[model samples]
Target: MTDCDFLVVGHGIAGATLAYVLRQRGHRVLVYDPGQANSASNVAAGLMNPVAGKRFALTWRGAELLPFAAAFYRELEQRYEQSFFSETPIFKLFSSLEEQNAVLARSADHPWGDFVAGFDTTDPGLPGTHAPFGGAWLQHGGHVAVRELLAALAVEGTRAGWLRRETFDWAQLATSSDGAVYAGQVRARHVICCEGAAAVRNPYFHWLPLTPNQGEVLDVECPGLSSAQVLNRGAYVVPVGGTRFRVGATYRWPPFADGITAVAREELAARLSVITELSFAIVGQQAGVRPAVRDRRPLLGPHPTVPALSFCGGYGSKGVMLAPRLAVLLADWLDGHADIWPDVSLQRYNTLQSVGVA
Candidate 1:
């Protein structure tokens, strides 16, 4: 009997994006952050790149998803009168001649291969390609100023009386046949959990085999670099355009102790040295567990028995590029518009009772 229509857990990117959508749809949302450690979104490099490097495959649903993400962020920028979308080019350094050839060959296969800018220049940087190699240019591959955007939205929501800040204690959550018992607002007809890595702890959906990873990034000072672009060979050095930059998002799987680790910093530092000659100090280090699922796809849909509850998380490292479209689909389903992204929907998993295993 506290208050709220929808009690969204976690204020990270997943929750934030969903909340924004709900608000736009004219629903009340009370987010429960609980003031826990920031999740991956807080410390993410925020690079929304369409072309995946390793597999040389575009992001899953990248064609449709990227446009949604770009438009969504752009709309937010317009509404809030804030500028966070910085369109910069990203240069991917090739590791070997073989990789460069593969990239060039793939470009030939696609008619719109112009997006993949290829260069014959053999030199990229010191400790250059492992073998004779160059790099590929990717347009529309830039970063979101997540920190600034989150802050701006929070302030906007607060002033408009659309948001409340507090820890969401699950013990207080009571589900009825109809909807949910939140604080007092009773704003939403349903509750969606976007709690990132912590979703594993929720009693209702913990069994979903989530593989959480604790990732850390080093905030370094690089004043001289003119081009505000993402440079990658081994580790990515994303320019933040403030004489400061973000580098080395080292991923540590199998859950370890929380907080930044020396090993992670050292590893990141070693990688950063590959591209930059200037010495930079680690001005800041932030750590958060990414909400990763074993399937590597987002977990979406409603709870089996408790139809009033639903969730959308586990986009892993690709949250920036994935969340907007997924949120739209969730909003559509909630608004009774359309059912989409069935692959990651919650309906895929039966309730604990149905499975006979907790």
Candidate 2:
């Protein structure tokens, strides 16, 4: 029977990052991943934007999360001897005069003012682009090649003989105060489900208000759009490589299935045209479901009654930035260093105990 200090289910950013940190801290971790192709982390464009939304409000906890994420990814790069993180600036284009005023107004404040590096009153010199009102250069904004990062982590975990590409069965999982029994064989000190959107199906964590959001993004070849920085207005166009960019990312609610569609493609193309008049060819499209929550905060901490069971999911669209710090918090709590933050704790959901778990 395999035995480990921790058994982590799911291999998305949440799971992979947690495992990476835990392993570095000298703990035995066994990761059981279903290897779902359309998982959110695999399909993410990995944009770590400090300022988001129509109001141009600074992201929740962006000030603290951004620097932590940067340093964490830097450490990962050094550890893995690979480069997947880049500090790419984001130019938030003004959609209207009102929006431009809003940016200026918000930039005059505390947190918002702190992140705005400068404003571009005139076009930032991108040919065939429409930025008459200009935009703001956001500080601490960047991109993480999330897919590459996950792959590297998986490779390292597998090479260390701690990762298994298999679906975990809850039916065989039995928890006690000290540890957990998985598949009637594997013994683990704790079991953390980081199953992303699939966590909604987890009997242990199904009660959490996880709203699965379907998002689609396109990869395009735009030779004329040579700006290296990310451009965001109605849509975001991020330069991933030479003459290639990651674009689109339309959000759909009811239709939570992970599948590409013509409507999303058309909407993305139209949005791209609005961002730039340059002709571009669509290279490909990818879609995935984000594990968002009702309050839009992460869901972490242990099951109220089941001490050996825990969870780390529902990071929504901000997983890239949120994972590192949140993982540290979860790992520290597990090791008895501290308690999970009140906002992110599963204890906030009073009805979880009522839903019942086997």
Candidate 3:
């Protein structure tokens, strides 16, 4: 017999959010974290962009994901009593005349017109920031203080008696006809792996093509360069309060190692220099692997053979916007109230045949 309803491995944003949702559904949950040295959730700037890239196209399912994400964060704020989410605008700095025309043309269309507006030199609202061809203001996008949110949720999870700090030993995990037994540690009706990039190492569901990408970011002190909106040029410059700004994120796949490098640091500095002429000092540098999928959609659902084993991850850089809503879906599926979305289902790999569809 299982001692708990679920055993959630990896307490990152994806895992934490799933655990939180399961608890709300009145399930007994126990979260396990091996304490990796680097985690993308902690290193991420947590920017949720509704419209992305130089082409100024709407992000995948932006209209639905944005609102659902906003409500999720708001509910988290009220429940955790922590102010961590900031609803700010994102200003896409036009790179050239041709780029400017492309975005402007898209903004003049339907749906895109609702969230995008053109702005010239008068905007960006800061000097030294270069936007020779003007830019676009993307509405309904902002940043989340992921580190704070994750920390707060960890505390709440502990208080609620649903968290354990220890490495999950797969060798000790024994699956059965009904559930899983984690040696003498615990028996659980479900074992959900929200292991992020570590999912690549997951034995049960590693067959899924999860491409882990290493991303680097720099936390800098830019005195007198604060802005209410995120500046997006080649790279993003997000204000994190006071004189601190998180400038980031160079995506490098098949990384040689898992730490900050001089090359990445220089690239980030150059990106910051191009977007804003503001002088800044690097406060710190961080690097973490993002759990990206080949198809660019999140991975979800249970193991074909072992019903108790499940997975929910690969939100990639959009974890801030995707995790919350996905968590709800995961919980519903686990409770037999709904089925996992086909797009994200691991069954798509054609490697595992479903026992039966929900």
Candidate 4:
């Protein structure tokens, strides 16, 4: 049997980042992933937006989390010598005059002004976009190439003989007060479940309200439209490379909805149309389940009953912006160097009474 300090399931952004951090901290880490193509991390555009929603509210701890995440990705890029993270401005086109006024008013009095790179009053921001109400260029916003990063991590982990590319069978998992043994082939001091939306089915941590959210995105080839910035108007048009942009993300409820639908395609196309007059062709469509929580914050810390079991999922759509810092915190907690914040700790659910299983 192979002995390790930690066994992390699911190689999505959350698991991958956590595993990398744990390994970097000099722990023996084994990552188990089936490499499902439609997993949320694989399909996500990895957008890092500090301000979100129609109200343009700042993300939870945006000031601290955004910069920390950027530095984390940069460190990884430097270590691996690869280009996976892009630091670009996000041009948020205003949908109406009221929206523009609201942002301006907020910028005048609130801390939102710190994130505003520029604000246009009357002119359309981008060349082909229909920004009648103008837009706001947000600073400290960008994207990470999640798929590439995962592949790079997998390569390094495999090279180190710690990453296993196979399905993990729950039936064969054995756990005691000391640690966990998987299929009697891998033994670890703790087993961290990063199983994204699939965590709802995990027997150990299923009670934590892990809501699976279905999201879809479209890949388009727009020859006429070109910009280094991500253009946003409800749905965003992210520049991938040379005329290829990813137009995405429609949120749908009731998770595990398989396959992409024409309705989503139409909705995305309509959103893109409202954003830009540039002609485009939809080259591909993808659907995945985001492991969102009912409260929309990440779930961290050990299982209520089993100290050998832990969880680090529930990143939702903000995984790209939130995972890196959260991973470090989780690693610190695991190493007995820090405590998990109450807001994100699994104990916040107060569901221990019902969680009698281990």
Q: Provide TM-scores for the models.
A: 0.91, 0.97, 0.94, 0.97
Q: Write the per-residue lDDT of candidate 3 for residues 1-358, one digit (tens) a residue.
A: 4399999998888998899899888888899986664799999999999888655678887888888988889998998788888888888888888877765565555657466654663344565577777787777889999989988977776686677778787878999979889977689989999999887777776677888999999999888775778989888999988888899889999945759999999999999998777789999999999999998999898887887899999988999999988999999999899998899888787553333211
**Model 2 C-alpha lDDT per residue in residues 54-159, reported as the tens digit of each score:** 7778898888999999999999899889998999888888887777887777666655746788998777776657898888889887999999989898887778
Each prediction's whole-model lDDT (CA): 0.75, 0.88, 0.84, 0.88
Scored against the true structure, residue 34 in model 1 reaches a CA lDDT of 52
Those runs of model 4 whose alpha carbons end farther than 4 Å from true positions after fitting are: 352-358
Clashing pairs in 3: none
Positional deviation of residue 7's Cα in model 3 after best superposition, in angstroms: 1.0
187-208 per-residue lDDT for model 1 (tens digits): 4467888888887888777877
* RMSD (CA, angstroms), candidate 4: 1.7
Provide the lowest-lDDT 10-residue window in model 1: 123-132
